[model samples]
Target: MVTVTAAVTEASSELIARARAGDDEAFQALTEPYRRELHVYCYRMLGSVQDAEDALQETMLAAWQGLAAFEQRASLRTWLYRIATNRCLNTRRTAARRPATQWSVPGVEPPEPTRLGEVAWLEPYPDSLLDEAADAPPGPEARYEQSESVSLAFVTALQLLPPRQVAVLVLRDVLGFPAREVAAMLDATVESVNSALKRARAALRRRPPRAQHEPAPPAGSAAEDAIVAKFVNAYESADLDALVALLTDDVFISMPPMPFEYEGLSAARDFCALFLGTGREYVLVPTRANGQPAFGLYLRADGVCRATSLLAITLAGNRVCALSRFDGSVLPRFGLPQSLPDGP
Candidate 1:
């Protein structure tokens, strides 16, 4: 086993060397590891999956053409990030951003939920991908830096930041790049990076405090699983009483890009009861969001799939403390298919 592990490590090292030497296949192997994360970074920066993918391809092309100029100054990972971040910012400058939609897809009809609150721009991410473990190690700062950046709220909030501030904060805070390195990436001084980070932190603090959920479910305890099961049943059933029973009295729920947010269980319950399960029946296709159990909710309208929403419930201990409903158009970012299996 030890010998086999060493061989794999040596092979990966060889691939990196060859890639650095301008071998396409070797470079492909070397770059593959960073693709998903880089794409994710672009998505956060641009707030569009299509744009992020385009930027990812552009970053690779640039990296390949400039491989000869690659000095061993920074790790290959950081170099790629520098390239990807620049691409995203450039795209942001030129790209035409479509207004966000809260419903599932372009063609799908939507059910009447209370007055829509400018949530059309908010989108859903697949729960499956959010459940996947991140490749990067937990950075030096143990808190506020985790895979949760993949969450819709975190990403949406990031989009609200200035483009440069977005890159600086993400590189320094999310990806754990040092201040000096971030400065180099942005072609700015360390002091500038510090200033940007300060403003970014201040802006973020003003937003609703999001719960930092655990990445992986607790092992074999059944605590989180039980909670998730109860949530699924309560939500799909539209049983407001059962749902409120599982929540704390002071539980809060908010959807970003929309001004409407609810505080307290009664208000939340009333909102859900009135808005959800009113005219259409809902089928929750289970997925993960915000590093917690989430559902890809499909609302049937006229016996056809109409609307989809991504729901991530934040639990405090075993009680649901917050529930965030995001629009479904962004599910592709999470690799969730547009159509779910029928009646599963």
Candidate 2:
């Protein structure tokens, strides 16, 4: 084991040397392995997938340009995370985020929302990309499971935190980086990092707890399939009663970029009723987002079917606890077609 470790270290040294010597291929080779995880890290810091991608690109560029400054005091993975985190912080500070969109569904009047959501720019992360990024287990100090850390609820809560607090919380609790390392990454003292983390944790605790619901079924398991199948049947058939039956008592609904939020079974049912009463036929295409079940909704009208919205649901055992809707602009991100052939 010692001999193998030494050989691996030597090879990594050679790669780093070549990378610093301006060999683009060597840089790519050295950085490619960290790409997916770094992207996930950036996504956690910045809710929008587009923003995460931009931050990731900037991180790579900066890392490559500053390769000579890498003193190797920390592991490559840690250094990459530091760069990604800083890039995300810069984005959070300077980027013009998407504003809240008005409710504009034709022929359907939306009920009074329980409250407007604060994170209007929130976007779903496709599960297809999560497999490899989440495969590696988090470090020993990680307080959140890899799956929980990526959920919509978690990501939304993170967005509500101050950018530095978010960084401190994620680095210390989610990724399990030591406080000293996080302090170094953020250019702050360890005492400040701990203080920020404490405040972040208290704020999160004040939010509604997801633990109240029963645990969701495993992905792709028969239990999950049954719940998804029922949802599709009820939703596509426009059976409001059946759909309501599948929701938890505290079911929550939010439409991002629109700021509308509905909580409780009654409010959720009312919202669903409004959409179903639109006198339009609908179709659902299965997809996954944030490690949960999602569908691309298509509206059939005038003998033509066009994509309408993307819906992602959070399940608690057999019932759905939350529903998040995003505008049709995100369909392409899931490889969903803009339109489908008109048929039964």
RMSD of 1: 5.1
Residues 48-129 of candidate 2 have per-residue lDDT tens digits of: 8998999999999999999999999998888988999999999888888788889977777889999999998889999878
TM-score of 1: 0.76
lDDT of each: 0.70, 0.90
State the weakest 10-residue window (summed lDDT) of model 1. 111-120
lDDT of 1 by residue, 72-170 (tens): 588778899899989988876676656643443334333333343433344444445333423577457423555567655577688777788888878
Candidate 2 clash pair list: none
Scored by lDDT, model 2 comes in at 0.90
